[model samples]
Target chain A: AQSVTQPDIHITVSEGASLELRCNYSYGATPYLFWYVQSPGQGLQLLLKYFSGDTLVQGIKGFEAEFKRSQSSFNLRKPSVHWSDAAEYFCASKGNTDKLIFGTGTRLQVFP
Target chain B: EPEVTQTPSHQVTQMGQEVILRCVPISNHLYFYWYRQILGQKVEFLVSFYNNEISEKSEIFDDQFSVERPDGSNFTLKIRSTKLEDSAMYFCASSANSGSYNEQFFGPGTRLTVL
Candidate 1:
């Protein structure tokens, strides 16, 4: 079955530190991958998405993700973390239909 | 900027009662979707709608669950009989089109609590 995996459940980073969250996906065809962030009491916000072409995609809030086909991974990265960036991050892939299959999210906690 | 909007930020209902969650998707979008996140769980897709009909649905969308675009502006999800397990944050989303490149804009979800 097609699925997205987020190996990390929780991650902590001091403010201004570099951050990376891992994601892997299993799909039969070239997949459409996405990264979304959900803050407490807020909706899921799209950070970035990779459909085709360039391996690295830039998204809002200084977030970026690289799609590595060989590794079947699309991991999110940020050069410097902010207190506001602390939220639950989810990795997802569009299924054959319009639905998105999401991984168990990784919660990021930022310390000042 | 245009954004999806949902009514009633939170709803509390007794088990076995019916509840309707309403949403207004981006005005020009053709596709609408409903997803839910149980507390401490991944967001799960429940159903997708387009052109006044359901285009796709997940296993979790059982007979009791139904979606409707009642008019031009409102999309609603109705649970015939709510269960305790139905407690979740229900989200409504829409994209300009169904294309792979179209980003789905999400709305602040409606939190449904069943007792």
Candidate 2:
């Protein structure tokens, strides 16, 4: 079975500070990884995705993720996070069975 | 830019009642999907539809749930008996192609509250 794990349940970061959210997955083959953000009461917004080739993939809203196959990790990072960046972050991996398994999610709290 | 859209931003229903959630996927998309997120839990996949038929469905998708593309633009999910556990944000997504790497555009979601 394929599963995604986001270690951080909640994270607080100051505005303009760098941010890194950890994600790990268990899969048998090379997995398709994705990062999504959801504001309170809003639907998910895709951040980035990794299918093949490049380990580092850039996404919308100044977000990026690096896929590490050896570690089974796909971590999301942002050089500088604005206060508006506060939201719930989820890491997901495509399952062969026809669904994307999502992580429990990490609530990002950005402080001034 | 094209995006998926869902009807009924929120629906309050009684237990055992039937509820239908509607979604209008991106016009040019060929695949549609349904997923839900229970409060404080991970988002879970329910089913996927393509070519006017179900391509795949998850274990969470049981006999109680069914999906239909009644028209060219509308994709609907019907729950036969609403349970308290069914209360969650239901999201509709669509992709131009069927692949793990294809981008799936999501809608605002409809919050289903079963009382």
* Predicted model with the maximum lDDT: 1
Expressed as tens digits, the lDDT of each residue in A2-86 for candidate 2 is: 9999999999999999999999999999888999999988889999999899899999999999999899999999999999999
The stretch of ten residues in a row with the least summed lDDT in candidate 2 chain B is: B96-105
lDDT of 1: 0.95
Candidate 2 lDDT tens digits, B45-68: 999999989988888899999999
Global lDDT of each candidate: 0.95, 0.93
Query: Which of the numbered candidates is closest to the native, going by highest TM-score?
Result: 1
- Quote the lDDT for A39 in model 1: 92
Off by over 4 Å in 1: none
lDDT by residue (tens digit), candidate 1, A10-110:
99999999999999999999889999999999998999999999999999999999999999999999999999999999999985577899999999999
Measured by DockQ, the strongest candidate is 1
lDDT score for residue B114 of model 1: 98
